[model samples]
Target chain A: MINVKQEIINSIKEITVGHDIQEFIEEVLLSDLGIDSIKYVELLVSIEEKCDVEFDESDLGADALKSLGDLINLVNKTLEQKVS
Target chain B: MKQYEVKNVPRYFEPHVNDCFANAYATVLSYMGNNPNFILTDYLNFMYDEQTEHIGINFFFRATPTVEFSEEELNSSLELAYLPATSMFNKTSPIDEVTDKDKVQINMYIHEDQDIAFTRLKERIDENKPVIVAVDLFYMHFHRAYQREHGLHAIIVTGYDEEKRTLKIIDKYKLSSSDFDGEISMDEMSQSRLSECPLNNPMVGEYKREIRNLWMEIDIDPDFKMNVERIYSIILESCKRMKGQREVLGHECGLNRMEAFRKDLLLKKESFMDRKLDERETYLFKTYYNSAFKSISRSRMRFKVFLEESNLAEKEDLGEVLEQLENALKRWDICANLSLKLGIKKSIKLVDDIVRQLSSIIDIEGEIINKLTDISLTRDLVTVSKNIKDQEM
Candidate 1:
């Protein structure tokens, strides 16, 4: 009974400070949120550690991480695969 | 399949300074039993093109090609240098197929699945072939700082063992002292090869014969002189091209680009004061500064080597020119260190002083080049007269 979205939001908060979690929308670009290339990697590592899920090489490609929604969907998909 | 690794792969460190494409190409040549140094000198001779970009603040120098040397130039040089090597793969296409050439061939193989790519790579390694792979630096443990960023890098896979699930890789970075040779897990290797952030292009170079009697057919003295002329022309044109131009980030070339970089430091300082300096800008500043510093340092090193190897190091005027170049390089090092230690604000203050020093060095370099050109032309005339007299006799 893990709240995957909440877990992701919490992980994002820990990695990036000063961002209002409630205002985070699915359509907002990660770059607009000040998540640069290096910071984006850090966020991915943080989420992996918090969720205890390892992203596959295919999952980490450029096409997989376009926006907040994309990242959230990826985490959910990986979580589902883990449970199965 | 039997496990194997190629011996005497030329290890080129100084990743921050030397071009990785050149280093990887050198490694392949060394593995094929060729003198990497001689080949590198020959290749660098033809790589410079006199292209100028007018950025707003200053003219940027675009002297060298950002990509590898053209396939025709590279392949023909291999043949001319008597290396018994030929490249059959097309440069425009992605990893397609391996075509056999004389004694060695450059191969590219593309597979959508990571496992398939690893399988193909392992097949080559089993045959004692060292593969040159284009990988995203983010997945490499050695370059963790660049994680998730699509920084493409080249490395040689020398050996692999299925039982141990490890692959032997050679990476040269940070001066000759930091050459890397170790076993990374098969998983890491596969991920690096299959990274899609950057285009997934996996290339493996295979060499069979050891090159003996390493001789370059081109007349060393005249060719070297021509290279020197080319270098001087590029630098001189860059200096003159800076008139009434605004500084631009991506468009600046040569010394003009260096001046534009100084302007960037001042702008960065303003951004820092406003608390608007982000991680990306910081990363770009460091990259541009290092590249500018390394270009000058590498040029100085190349010329010094050329002079020493050609037995011209003892020339009184040329020796003085070398000393001037060394002093300029030292000042550049100091400027770089100062910028790193004291943030942008203090460093911006030193920019004008450093630019003036660099301009003076360029003027001195131009004078020395004029002297060298005179000497070269005189020697050529003397040789022509001797040849004519011999023919008449």
Candidate 2:
């Protein structure tokens, strides 16, 4: 029931200043947007704080989140485990 | 508008996102050789620099955004200070390493007229040669920094579509295996080139160069060998610089700079205590954190590969150095990750832990230098000091 997609968009909106919020589609590759590794970490931390989901070290490795869909999937999986 | 492209312009795989100039240079060389072996690691490119400026809120702590080697240090090197050259662009690269006599030489085309540069770029492409172009992505809509972040990034322009007014480009610097091999309108590319993009990076400190219509071309011999030995010399040169970090070019160098960095971070504990860093502060810390990680961890890995590639693989201390480097390399990653996390969390404990890690890295680097020096001396390798004397003579 948690709107993880909206939450992720909201985190992105929080980081993005000056520009109006563009629609961030799920299949969009984060790299295409030029999100470097450090910025990616900030985004992860922002999402963790907002969604109350902690990303494990395995999830934080360079290969972890490829696309917005992948991040959403990871967060949803973590959220699922939290309820269980 | 018309359409033209240099076919098979290569892409660089080892780009660390911020290293566009290096990537563009390598791509040109790789395209020249048409060899996968030419795609080498940038282990030789690292340099040491520490800032004299201090963090604003806490003037006691140095702003020290330079945990990694970058172009700023490259530009600061005394030998190449003969910049402000007879051209519209003053950017220099390590093309000398790969400058094969009668085989390869990098040439720059610059003009007071932006159209001249554009015409030159088109000429090279028409001749089936890819052109390396400098552009400020802020003015270019095809880039993420469009009207957002202002900085100069080198891109390889392969083709021009006259009717569509587009240019096919290869901008491979991306986040983790991501790349761009596509088209941008000529208007977009021209605008990017013409805009005066003051280098906005904290490390490079406001390099306000004319980005207008400057492009580079390299004439290559079909039988050119990839300069792997240049990498070997550069590797040794980098180590010698580390050994001589105390030689006083300016502010603190090598481990001494690291110590200052540690003390600063530790001192920032009270100011940064449990406070989430604002986005502006986060960006600065992020630059330092990411740069340090790439410069140390990735460079060491490539150095290990170099040892394996060279005759040094037979040496007794080879395995020892490799194993120790591997261990230290992991710690650099861990430290960098902690630093990244610290940007958000702002914890004092993390600062202490990073300092501990820094101390370990410094010790390891010192030992590695000693070991590498012994190896280089035994191998009769030419060192950086020798290179300087040779240059002077």
Candidate 3:
């Protein structure tokens, strides 16, 4: 079984699909990776499919996905809650 | 005003006519059952409702006629036969009073063998007179069936085209007079029977009546979000099956349909391998995949060119033109960036080329739209732009 940290990272990688993760993290959200509202929805959808978990809108807050660590932490908390 | 015969319809509405019949029938059902201004969800809901007593609804927008006909049939039903009902409604929004300063009259009895209503609608157009036609082709199809089913003799000649001799009249199911070799004979129409009344054979009349209700009653809600979830689900499901087949073979056999068809496929297959990738690695994959997919989808330059041609041909209102252009750019960016990330190099080039061409048209459309800004004009333009965009794809 994949851990929450790895799952979130995998989700991020899946979102990027081609390049290195750090480069994507720096360029995609901070600069313009062309992430519009629709694309964001698509990203969430892909994550949900890959992880087999539904993400609440609240969990998808802008601040929650600001950095790699924050995203990993959010996923861990969500997965822990799911397990409990 | 041109006249054409309707025959060789699909098995869906076999021996009836085109897909328009099914679409029209649905429209009628929707119209009869639901309140006006209902959204697409409401439209789907009305269709899903199973109650036989409830009216069925369906609708069609901007459909082209299929069959070809003669000048006589075209002239006889110009105003009453061949015009879009929406155009008439759009022109006279207050609903009631419409001027008939340029109306033409034709001698219906003059054609002994042909239908009077059909003849007049066709004949009038031969003289070059504009007509207000009903936009409900769905209505036309159902009404035609209803007439044949119910033996109804009455026919309403709805519209006609002066230039083409096309008559857009609704005899029973709102079928145009031109769709037939000879206008539906009133005597023949009257003799037709509905296997039994609604009180007797509910099934027979049910389909026809349900369709009729949709056209008359259903209202389309302006706000519609096209859900691509269903498409995505299908794609993902196919991917899953393919992956499952690959895992079962365990590198012993090669990829083929036989692997998937094997009876023990599920048992032999392995699960999606679990991997302990870090946060950064996961992010990279997701980003790349999303971008790649977008780029692949947006790479069609023909679609962009079609949109431009449609805009020019239709000369739709400017505000709408600008709005569509902006939406196109948004879509382009989403799809193009995704393609680049996906490692679909060909798709990236296609997306880039389309985006460049589209950008120029967007600028031109934007300028035109900005120069003219009236509420009415803007609304009309938006409608036109939306129609063009939907059809372009």
Candidate 4:
């Protein structure tokens, strides 16, 4: 099985470009990821690809996701379920 | 046919693969060849600089709505749509309630010549077993460059010759007009070349067989603001009408207007007159229509700027620029909408609360680009660092 943390880390690295993820996650909202909404959707799609799952349109609701941790948590939960 | 030349017409590029124009182009191209499967992409490393070039061509045809389709979940992550045509080569997958096996596909095809292609289509469609070929309109924008200035636009691809430097178009400019045909030289393409073309005439024949979508722009300037103004006025007027009705209804029942209005909404009585609001869905209707108008305005401006500044001779970076601008606009748009929604629904103050949210959109756009650049730079740095370490070893 693919390492879930490693997969998440790689995906985050791909988007973060070279910026310290630790800093971004701690300091920035998920919306500040420096990409457009389309890219954000792409990131979600990428996450789905990396984790092997799908995200629904409902996940895009305003209050649905508040921070990077929330998003990562959501991805982790989905990944865990997929693994199970 | 009158040979019209376009001087300094505007051009546009989709910032990403989901661009409306690219999707529309791809659909049309797919319809032509009877291939319903196409993947639109704007992730090309090359960028087409659109600010300085003008493409000129004349077209004669009309546009009809086409249905979009997607591949099934796994192996088919791509969404495809059929372009309007009279006949198709391949039978479309059965849609619910569409049981006609003899149904002519409404996709069109582009060919070496417009007159020949269109005549062939008309004749084939007349045979009742319509061929599933669609017309290509990628060249129509060039042919109809003049008409765009007048806000008269049509989409159809008739024909082209890279050697002869000519293109023919079929467009639907007037309601009464049928297939209008015309052509233009490739001089405009030469002028509007971006800074990143790896090959000469990279855009040439890109839409011949199939064109993928990369991004969509909704022009949101004067026209958009006006649309918002109009909708707000109408909705506000409706609110006033409701307020007045509430006052009357409440007076009759000895209740406050708000209370009466709320009660009337709750109580289904025959006394409720047919209000224009019967067709209204406040959030759904308002948001969608407003979004469309905004898109139109912003798209038009972007197109204008792109055409005005493009150069055809440079190894233009057509793809990257388009994607960048698209990223900028879309992110800003989302932030703007979110801010408005928060203000309206959450009663957030417009100044401190909303501006901060709205401004973040631009920041996000800037940062994303910066981040990408940063990532690229860091990758280079790492490569150099690895190279130096290897040399030392």
Best by TM-score: 2
Give lDDT for model 4.
0.33
- Chain A TM-score by candidate, in order: 0.77, 0.80, 0.58, 0.61
As a whole number from 0 to 100, the lDDT of residue B48 in candidate 1 is: 14
Q: Can you rank all candidates by lDDT, best first? A: 2, 1, 4, 3
Candidate 1 per-residue lDDT, tens place, B115-174, comes to 545665666666555677766567777763346455556778888877788888888753
Best by lDDT: 2
Could you give candidate 2's per-residue lDDT for residues B302-325 as a string of tens digits? 566656665544368777877777
lDDT of 3 by residue, B1-393 (tens): 354332222111111222233223333323234211111111110011112211111111111221122334323112211212321112124322222322211111111222433453344334332222222222223343343333212223333434544434332222222232223332332222112212112122232211111111112223322233322232222223222222221121111222222212122122212434343333322343333323322222222332333233234543364455445434444433432332222212233333343344334433423333243344457869999999999
Which scores higher on TM-score, 2 or 4? Answer: 2
TM-score of each prediction: 0.52, 0.68, 0.20, 0.23
List each model's interface RMSD.
14.6, 1.8, 9.6, 9.8
- Say which prediction, candidate 1 or candidate 4, comes out ahead on TM-score: 1
Model 3 segments more than 4 A misplaced: A1-6, A15-20, A23-31, A34-74, B1-45, B49-393
The DockQ value obtained for model 1 is 0.02
State each model's CA lDDT, in order.
Answer: 0.49, 0.61, 0.31, 0.33
Global fold similarity of model 4 (TM-score) = 0.23
Candidate 3 chain B: minimum summed lDDT over ten consecutive residues — where? B39-48
Pitting candidate 1 against candidate 2, the one with the higher lDDT is: 2
DockQ measured for candidate 4: 0.02
